[model samples]
Every structure is written in structure tokens, then in C-alpha cells.
Target: MSHTLLNESNADQYRTRVTLLGTAGGPPWWDGSDRTGISTVISVNDDHYIVDLGEGWGPQFRKSNLGPVGFQKGLDNVRAVFVTHHHSDHIVDLPNLLLLAWHNGSDGLKSPIQIYGPGNRGELPPIFAPENREQLPEVFNPDSPTPGLTESAAKLMEAYALDINDRMRDNAKQDLRDVFEFHDIELPGTTGDRPNEDPTPEMEPFEVYRDENVRVTAILVDHRPIFPAFAFRFETADGSVVVSGDTGVCENIVKISADADMLLHECIDMDWVDTLMGPNSPKPDANLMQHMLAAHTSIEQVGPQAQAARVKSLVLTHLVPGNTPAEKWQQAAAGYDGDFYVGEDLMQFGIGAPRG
Candidate 1:
């Protein structure tokens, strides 16, 4: 089926719409790809909630035109934020959002923008294939090796104390403490106890947040070693949208996304992984290659996963490598007949019927 491009001009028809802020995945600056980073926004009428704060999110958000026009008004309507994981590619620009909010109209925020993310892992993950290495690398922060969103934000604020103080006292900006609040999403008591042994246990989705406009639920996904990685489902009155944060094909994803209107999933190009890390490379590492494939869903795997969920539409975002040809990515439509789209930055998808 031909893909339909959704945008703001036709957004009036649906009660809820989602905009792709930046679709690129990973840390490397990909060749021949201008895609910024991985980020998205689910807008309900006038308010919007953001997911992930990847690199270049700030500029791309402005280009999206989701907020009101004029000075310092870009993030005025950002009601909340959800971080799927602690991957640098997914949250490197978080400082941009937190620090720049003062200059970007966070003062106009109706209430503190609630930020939610994974909590601290009580212990450090095991070293991957440790026997081969001569010596183990020293732990970076011994006391608090794996700080979660709440602690991470506190440290971030501490790091920027000089600048934050300069802005607040000299420029007379609103207290950032009053503008934002951070929360570490608590996992279900039964599961998530064994992070290294079983990072993603098969379990039903649980509520993480809810408001007047939408209810959000989360489930653990198989992004191994990177424990607590999640996939989020946003249910609005009009329809449901699920974001499959970085993960391999897992049953929990299909369970959370079951019957969702749209599933915005992450896709990796296995061929690229093979070329870079396969045996033919200068120094092949089988463990590294397998590790990459184990963490992300490939193009061939995504459609079947979407099919299993029975979603009405499947939009591919967080394109791995970020420079792969669109024609190659289109191959993902195989095995599924739903409306499939290769998401581009700033593109919008409205849910439910259009206005008369």
C-alpha cells in the first residue's frame, strides 16, 4: 500500500496527532543522512508530551512548529516528558531541554513539566565476555555506578549551577525547580528484581502516568545489559499509540502495543551490522555483532512484530545508521499489510477520523 503523508494542515480531522521530532538513532554522525536524533511528541489538542531528548532535539522541535509563535514560546505547552532509556543517543541533549527551557518560554508553563525515566540499577551490569580481556576497566563512578533519572537530573543541575544561578539572579528567570519535576518510574514489584539475569521478564504493561488528556503505560523490553529499557503506550480518547523503545523482538512489546492505532517502532539494518562487524571486516568480533543484533529489531523483524500486535498502522522511526536508502527501508512492509510509513523529521500523524 502507498504511504500517506500526515501533517499539520490536515491534523484538524483527528483528535490526537503525533509528530516525529528527530528520527535518527545511535551516536555516530551517519553519512548521507541529515536526520537529527531520536525524539517524538504526542499532541492532544493544545498540549504536547515529549518522548526522548536526543541530540539536536531543540532545533528540530522548533522546525516542527508544534508550539505557539513568538519569543521564548517553543516549549510552553510541553506537559510532560518520557525517557525510554539512558542511552546517550536517546538522552544526550537532555541538558539542552533542562537548561535552555528558561530562554525558551518555560516560564509560561502551566505547571511543572513532569519528567519520567528509568530508576537506578542497584548493582552494575556484568562485564560482557570478560575472559578475553587482559584486565577489566575501572568503574567510572564507584559510589553511584548507575544513577537513574531523578538522581541524574539532580547532578545535571549541580553541574550547571553557575549558569543556572547566572540566569536566575541576573536575568531574572523563573526558578527551574518550579518549572520542572523529575520522577524515576517504579517497576512492578514482582518483576525487574534480576536485572542482569533477566532484564525483560514477560509481564503485562503497567500504568506509569495519567492526565486529563492521555494515559501512559510501560513495559520492560529486551534491551539487555541496559536494564530497565521500556516501551511506552499512550492511550488517548481517540486512539492509542505505542513507542517501541530500543529493544529486540520481545513478547512484552506486542502485549503493550496490542490493538494500538499506530506502533512507532525502531528498525535496524542487519546488513549494515554485518558489513561493519561481520567476519569479513578487518577485525571481526562475533560477540559485538551478536550484541548489536540482540538489542535492536531489524527491518525484516519489525513488520512481523507489528503484525503480531494487530496495529492499524506501523510507522518506522529511529532508523538505524540513519542514512540507509528509503527504498531499502520500504522492504520492512513485507509480512504486514497495515499502513507503513518511513517516518521523516517533522512529519505528523493524526489519529481517528478527519474533520468534515
Candidate 2:
């Protein structure tokens, strides 16, 4: 099936559209790939809400022209930010947004931009392979190894105290605390009680935030060993959009994405994983292969999940390896009869119908 590309010229056709700021997944710089880290923006008219802050998202966001142009005019229409999880690839550049907003026009905001993310895991994850468990690695930040969004933001500012102080005292910049508010997304009662043992329990999606433009709901997805990893659904007057974040095939993803207009899900090429870590390689590690597959959805698996969700459109993002050919990723459309597209950086999609 042919994929219709959406851009700023045709943005007015729909009241709500999603813009992919960056589509690359993981920390490694993939060979021969120019894709940046994974980040997305859901725009409702002039207002936009960000999901994830992967590397290079700041530059990508600015280039997309999601907000106003001109000096100190960017990020002015940013309504909120939703973090899928604390994974490095998903949130490594959070500091860029938090620290640079002052220079990017966060001062003119009508209200503090609300930032939401998963709370602390309450404990560190167990070691992946038993063979490697003999030599335990030292835990960093022993006192607060599992700091949640609130603490993470506070510490980030603390780490940049010198620059922040100089900017506020000399340049007259306001405190970041006043420009943004951090929130730790709380789970429903008894839903995430067993985080380590069972990270994702079968549960209904719960409302996390609501405003005039959108009503946001979240469900726990299985990105194993990463507790509270979420799949978020944004419901607006124009249509609904679901972000699968990063996960293997989990029923919770289907639960949250049901009947959505669009579902942007992550896809991994298992062939790549097998080539790298499967038996017959220089040094085969079956445990490592199993662990990788356990945490990420393979291309063959993602289509079935999207099909089960019954979403109208399935756009794949957060591509594993980041350098895999587009045809290799197209296998994700196997079981899904709905529209499918391989996401690209700065690509935008208009959801639902045009206003009359």
C-alpha cells in the first residue's frame, strides 16, 4: 500500500497530527544511518505535546517548526511532555529540553509546562544472565540509585548549578522550576505492586492527565526489567493517537491502543539480533539474545500486536539497529491490514478528517 506523506503545507487538513522529531532507537550510533534518537510530537492545532526526549530532539524539534519562530520564540506553544520510560535512548536528552527552554522561549508560557514520567522502580533490576552474575557491577548513586522523574530533574539542575546560577544572576533568567513542573506518574492502586517480578500486570489503562485539547491515558507495557514502562494514548477532538514506547508483545499495549486512529510502535529486526548474538557467531551468548528479544518487539511480532489493537494506522518508529533497510522493516505489516508506514525523522501524519 502507498503511504501518503504529510507536511506543514497540508497540516491544516487535520486538527490533530503527529510529527516524528527523530526515529532512531538505542544509544549506539548506527553505521551508515543518519537517523537521530526516538522522539515524537502530537500537535493539536498550534499547541503541541512532546513524547520522549531522545538525543538530538532539540534540534529536530526546532527544525520541525512545531512552535513559533524568531529569537526566544520557540517552545512557546508546548503544552506538555510525556516520557514513556527512563530508558537512556528514550530520555537521554531530557536535560536539553529542561536547560535550554529558557533560551527557546519558555518564559512566555501561559502556564508551567507539565512533564510526566514513570516514578522510581523502588529497586534495581536483577542481573540478566546467571553466568555473568559471578562478578556484580557496582551500582552508581547508591543512595538514590532509582531516582524518579522529580529527583532526576532536581539533580540535573543541581549538576548544572554553576551555569544556572550565572544565567539567573547575570542574564536575569528565571528559575527553571518556575518554567516547568515535574510529575511522577503514579500507578493505580495495587497495579504495579510487583514491579521486578512482574513488571507489566494485566490492567486497564488509567487516566494520567486531561486538558482542553487532549485526555491522556497510560498502561504498563512489558519492556522487561524496566518497571513502569508505559504505552500512552492521547485522545483529542480530532482523533486518538497511541505511542507504544518500547516493548515486546504485551497485551497491555493492545489494551491501551484499542480503536485508536494511529499507533506509532517500535520494531526490531530479529535477523540483526541473531546475526550479532545467535549461535555460530564468533562468541555466541544465548542468554544475551534471549534478553534482547525479551525487551524489544521483533518486526514479525509488532504487526500482530497492531492488528490486535485494531488501530486505523500503524507507523513504525524507534527502529532497532537504526541502519536496517526499509524493506526489512516492512515485514511489520504482515498481519496488519490497516495502513502501515515506516516512520522517518521529521515526518508528520494528519489524523482523522479535515475541519469543515
**Evaluated with lDDT, which candidate comes out highest?**
1
Off by over 4 Å in 2: 1-4
Which segments of model 1 are wrong by more than 4 Å?
1-4
Tens-place lDDT digits, model 2, residues 22-56: 99999999999999999999988778999999999
- Candidate 2 has a TM-score of 0.96
The 10-residue segment with the lowest total lDDT in model 2:
1-10
lDDT of each: 0.89, 0.89
Q: What are the models' TM-scores?
A: 0.97, 0.96
| Candidate 1: tens digits of C-alpha lDDT, residues 38-156 | 99999887688999998998998887777777874578889999999999999999999899887787445668999999999877989988997999999998989999999999999
